[model samples]
Target: MWNHFDTNGTPRTNNNLEGYNLKLNIHLSIASADIFKLISKLKIEEVDASLKYFRSAKNEKPPTRNKLYVINDAILLNQKQG
Candidate 1:
């Protein structure tokens, strides 16, 4: 489940989710928010994810990957094929 070599287009790691969690923590700005506030923030996240999904389904490209990651992916692809 952790491997990505045979799974094209799948995330190679949970970096995206980690980044999202970091962003959420920053937005919350509190170590312990009330239940209602937490729910509100989660709803916002859900809406954002849904919008991104729809945009992707419509062929709108998501943000470009970092150049370093792009290069690494290319290298891995070459190694996998060879």
Candidate 2:
């Protein structure tokens, strides 16, 4: 696990990927994971991080109907249906 050394000459671990490695280690510690389980967990965390960032940056609010927009959409939908 230790090949390269950090600037201090201490053998380094996965510090190259600081944030990600920390998260993966936490996941591994919490559960017994095979390679496939590890990959799946990483993928889910990646998506969760991406979505979290997206929502935070965009200030996304909870889904709610705009009454006027909903009514207009319903009218259009009814016309197509009938």
* Candidate 2 per-residue lDDT over residues 6-61, each given as its tens digit: 22323234544797778788878765668887889978988998997898799988
- Candidate 1: 10-residue stretch with minimal lDDT: 1-10
TM-score of each: 0.79, 0.35
Q: Can you tell me which runs of candidate 1 are displaced by over 4 Å?
A: 1-4
Q: lDDT per residue, candidate 1, 1-82, as tens digits?
A: 2266686877788998999889988988899888898899999889998999999999998898899888978877887888
lDDT of 1 at 24: 84
lDDT for model 2: 0.66
Model 2, stretches more than 4 Å misplaced? 1-19, 30-33, 60-82
lDDT of residue 36 for candidate 1: 92
